[model samples]
Target: MRSGYSELLGSMRPTSTNAVVAGEADPSEVIEVSVILRRANPIDVSRRRSVLTREQLTERHGAQDNDVQAVSAFAASNSLSVVKVSQGTRTIRLSGTVGQFANAFDTTIVNLDEQGAVSRALSGPIFIPEALNGVVVAVLGLDTRRVARSHVQLVQSQNVLSSFYATQIRDLYHFPPDLRGDRQTIAILEFGGGYQSADFATYFHQEGLGAQPSVEWVSVDGNMNVPGSVDDTEVALDVEVAGSVAPLADIVVYFAPWSELGWIHAISMAVMESPVLPTVVSVSWGWPETLWGDMAISAIDAALADAVALGITVCISSGDWGSNDGTSGQTTEYPASSPHALACGGTVLQSDGVNILDEVGWPGSGGGISAMFPPPPWQNFGYSGRAVPDVAANAVHYKIHFDGADAVVNGTSAVAPLYAGLIALCAESMLGSHGAGFLNFTIYEDFSAQSTFRDITAGSNGGYSAQPGYDLVTGWGSPNGAALLDVLETLSFAQVQLQLS
Candidate 1:
């Protein structure tokens, strides 16, 4: 073990396999890092029904003043400048030169180039002084390598066999009528690419959605919506699918860089910082658990758990790389692997224009047991590790418009927004006083909610096969929206009665 430090802050190796040592980082170059601090009070997700407001959370669970002071003192002693401190997310920002940061953290800074893209990386674990050992959770932005990948696959123009409009899928799923997600907000996180307003207008107009959903943009860490990039398809797919399904719900797209820091920043903005907090948050970008640092995974998972405690439902795509998640063994993806998140898988739909014919687990749907997290209280499948996905939807052959051109898209990325819109719709009616905090608990625990899914018992995604009850390939299968709404309404009534009693 390395000496001279009170504690080691986990490993900080590069995630990319293609990364190669380019050179030493410039010592004089200045950079800003986000230091995540531990919460004053631990969050209890079981009590998610008791939703807390931003103010309430700040008062109860925000960073302790002493911790912030300790971090500030440490920064001052190390010649680092304090940028900004957020008590809500417990993130402290500090700026310093590469050499200064290296000396402060007790690590070497080196440049790594993966293919043509370059980024700085840490050679080993991060170290902290004894005074700040438990106060600091993670120090992000030191190694700015690309972290997650967008799980979007586009079908070629000529190879497209069939496509369904987003609204059609909603209809086929039997979504409750007359609930247009009014007063509900859906937050979508984008690491890169952007959407064009014209495409939204044209696509909605073509879908016969009477009015386009109100769309907004929030930039985090200097990242903005820049069109024409490779990720445009992922961005456009999420917006169009979610917007078309919940035409009146406000959709806020948060653009951040593709790093662990950016991921946390975007999530914090949606869960803790947004002026209009979202009812549901959708994530279409992530990688397998093996690709992420253990502490980094814990940090993101903590934020997701906070979202649950705040009554915000989070939906994450399990990934598009099948049960192995692009790795050699059967593994699950992070964020999805986080038990607090509703992990969404993929399915192939074979339907007539008006009625459903059949749906099966997509060959590329990501699923299986998580290597990191233990099964949550809601899960009772006799598995030691958390099982994914919690639910699934059609991910093949989506009719979408992006960059002023209509295209066919496929992947589990589309499933996240689809569920986000559906949750928004459900939130409008079922959420009288309490938010739809964690649907997985009810779905897995209640018989009525469990009956709402059209169980998919066919097909496989490598190591796992779809079965009647719940399977690794497709979880509980696709939703019967109206049925689910009815179940939620009943549960809401029961909850209200319990409160009065």
Candidate 2:
């Protein structure tokens, strides 16, 4: 019989047709790859109050030792070096030359030119030994093609409807007055680009934020804070928005390469291995579901599940390309489409200093049904698949420091970090030190939680229209931050009681 992972391997494409083969990869150049192992027991973090420590989770759900040994033996036989292994993450890092990898996986490795970007790609199927067929799930880092795009767009001067500083937007959303996300940590994932300390200083200073929040940069796969690319705007927006809103919170940005392997590594390291574990993680980059292969999607979804099980909140920007998400037919972006994530959508807002004068769903906001994941029990909208966004916030007309200067940008990218900052404030209000994990159940099941939102009954994102209650375009609408804290506090109390019981 064929391998069970055949579909995933077949679906995984190294690059689009636009890329042309430049040359063969250097045979002697040593490279590293990440091999994902299957877990013995699956993890479910839905509506879970009890949290697990890194050690406990590893013991209960991580890969079996036998599996790890088998992979190591296979590496030894294939002349690949075992660089590292993480049982908690079910990953094994192997290093070998390009020629050894080609022979081991039964594929050709080549250099490809995709427009102006150059990448290393795989030209055929990755073979798996019959003995380890079911044990190994995914092999990443072989292909260096860019995996996803940041969803931020600069507003043309002529089309600027309204603009506000990141702090102004925070206050206009009615974020809790007493809480500045004290003692909370927000981890931001960046696939490319970087942030400069000077830009951050200038931004907070100009915004009148007396003291800047503390920030730390973590590199994954040797990717560092090198700015000046188009992606610099994305990095700037995330760091500034999240930091400005939660001024007392610690901000940790994990920089990684723009590949599937790099993406997975960034998230795993942030959630599992960070020095100061993050209470919430914000991801502003994503691709439509159709673009991600089954293996890549499954690997990421599993990692997100691990995050929630450990009581870490994962926030994802739904998308900025309307309901279609830049694909034909109605589609949603991955990671956001994953049920474990708090998918954030976008809105256009007109606020008069203290109150919201008008708020409507941004036409470019991404909201739709998922093609890969089933809706969790929390979602009761009768949709066959998981819904796109669980909540929304003002996305357009935001002031951010980008590429040495200030720029006005728009997209759901702003909303994820905005909500991530908000969640940090909520986490601060909780009775214990646990992070606010997996909020979809409460927001969908409890009317009290639903009441915290300012109902948006206007505008559309091409395929979906915003309505009084939950709609595809804006989900439960934008939040009233203080009210949300009140509801969350009550839930936290109940959770504590249940835990004690």
Candidate 3:
């Protein structure tokens, strides 16, 4: 049965033939492909599963010292090293070459039942250094008896709250109503799933934005379809924010798989290829730099450089775990740490009924100097003289309405898209008048310009701290979006004056 299952799974391909080429295909172009894995039966024990508490198993095998010892002895005999023996959870994580012990444990591990027929095995490669997050747990020598296990707790949705104070911060820098007409296109990149149309429509209506903006998905490496089984909470937030700020602009969502190679390919395709060239691309996902090799990092750098050269601004999330990021000490998440992209940090925004009281850097917002890429020429004028968040926005627990659900998720994930929408407005104002060749270059030029940003003078992210003007914690601080638009408009006027002179 395991062999049959493996063969069936291997036959499933996410991509389809005759797919529309991203960054170049028309809006009407449609491609059919498998968007998600079929939901496995909840009781199917043969499929891999996470390790539950021993008390959970003790119901079938009476809770006694002999039973616990027998299980431990059995694991030891099979070369399974106990990674973390948690007495509180009564759960143990084991690591070993699963292929060797397949026959011995295959029938004993059950899914979620009293019957001893199922197995609670995980699927993925097993690695050493037991306590590490995202490690694969495996039985010795059983190729099929493995699971991708990570120690991180999935934050319950109920724990999240609206950081609507960020919205007030955004309101403080309101631009002229006329600026909204300038935005043409804003592109958001997603690796997991698409957004639900109903959720999008409801969000825009509540925001008082008439007629929902057109949203389309650009497929990369296959997997281009509307919202599916994959969690789309992040994607929904991105689309809602971008659409709310720049309703006139068309939103292009680039969907790809979550694999490292797949992401690299999708980004490159989006940069080199999408039908409507986006003025800005917002990315909210990333892993630690240590998890990625030089080659992957270099590939991302190259792709970002290409995007910037094409007059496209790339906004990336700094990460959510602050500096520790589930790792022990100081560490920075990747892609955000990449120098070419505009790294967006987070802020905890507080407000009264009518005005914003304070906006400070979010400590959990990832920011710091990169151990890999050096500071780019454009970042040299900033304060602190280090590599980090080039800018910041209202990302901490911002209120957003998603598909029939109203919830808030905090992280630089929210900030990146928020800024992307702002940039779309900036581009709409400038591109028609000033002919700003590269948006990134324009941002660099404006960093020292007094009216370009609101200087965040407080807060810190573990190793780094924020200061007036510029700092690693919040970069140039959160934007006064309206002020920024005016600045760009003024710059456009100046360019016109120079041309006339």
Candidate 4:
């Protein structure tokens, strides 16, 4: 009988159709690859509280020693040097010549140029020893095309969105003054881009944040923050938004190279049970699951699951191109598609000179059924496949300080940090010394109770229309801070489980 690998191999196009980088993957040339192994068993993070104690979170999951040894031994046998292993994320980094990779995996590697970008990818079937079938799940960095893109977009119209400020929005949502994310740590992920201290300073000074909230830069894969640059508008928006909303929370921005390798590493870094663990993680970059191969998807989804199990709140942007996901049409993006992440959507919100007037799902907000993921049981009432966005925030226009001046920005990119800030505040209220688990559990528990939702009844994102209750366009509607906190204050995971049971 043919192995399951046969099907995945069949899906890739042959090397003949793609362009090759000059002298790439030559017998003498060396390359780096990541080997991701499967967990021995599934982890259970469902708990009586929202987030768990660090000790409880760490004890729940990790790579089995046997799996790690098998992968390390495989690398040694193949003449690949073992660089590093993250037991927390179940990943091993290896470096070897192209010839060794080709011989070990039974596939030739090729470089391809498409659009304006060039990438390295495998030309044929990626085979592994039959013994490693269940132990090893994926081999990444074989195709650099799996890199992710930032989801932020710039609004063409000026001044329309400048009137809105993060603090004001927080007030509009009725975020309790006592729960302003004090001492909470929020981690933001970036594939490639950086933020400037000066820009952050400008934003905070204007916002009158007596003293700036502390911010730290954590580099992954050796990519450091590129401060004061004209590029990377996405990074700037994230910093400004998070700073404005959760001014008291410490910000940890994870920067990495612009490939799938970097993306996974960045995510793993945020969720790792470090001395300073983050209460919430914000991801503003992603592409549809269709673009990410099974190897990449499996690894990413697994990492996200680990984060969720650890009681870390993972907030991801649901893309900016409406239902199309910037492709043919009606597709969804991942990390957002992963069951563990709280996928945030976008809305065109109107603020009366002082307060919010009307809010509708942004025409460009990404929301639809996932092509690769089955919708989580909590969301089965609305759709079959996993939905793009579980919640939404204003992405139409926002006042942001980037490249010196205050300009208007848009995209669901703004929504993740928006949700992250709220989570930090909520986590501060609930977890205290502990960290957070998935916020979606609480969100879905109250789906019927209807605490803290605006119920957007108008607007549409191409194929789907926003309706009463849960709809693809604006999942569970926008946040109503007071009602949400009220629901959160009295609820516990134990209570939710009891109610469900």
Q: What lDDT does the true structure give each of the candidates? A: 0.88, 0.87, 0.56, 0.75
**Which one is best on lDDT?**
1
TM-score per candidate, chains pooled: 0.97, 0.95, 0.65, 0.91
Off by over 4 Å in 3: 1-169, 181-183, 226-230, 381-386, 433-440, 443-451, 496-501
What lDDT, from 0 to 1, does candidate 3 have?
0.56
* Model 3: per-residue Cα lDDT over 80-165, one tens digit each: 55553322112333555424233223322112211332222223222222221111112221211111111111244667543452
lDDT of 2 by residue, 326-360 (tens): 87689999888998899999999987778888999
* 311-353 per-residue lDDT for model 4 (tens digits): 7779999888888887775788887878888989988878765
lDDT, candidate 3, residue 458? 85
In angstroms, the error of model 3 at 75 is: 46
Give candidate 4's total backbone clashes: 4
In model 1, the Cα lDDT at residue 211 comes to 70
For model 2, the stretches where C-alpha displacement exceeds 4 angstroms are 1-11, 47-49, 157-161, 431-433, 499-501
lDDT of 1: 0.88
What does candidate 1's lDDT look like per residue over 279-373, in tens digits?
Answer: 89999999778878877877878888788878888999999999899987888998888988999999999888888899999999999999899
Candidate 1 residues lying further than 4 Å off, grouped into runs, are 1-4, 14-17, 46-49
Candidate 2 TM-score versus the reference: 0.95
Best by TM-score: 1
| Residue 493 in model 1: lDDT | 83
- Backbone collision tally, model 3: 32
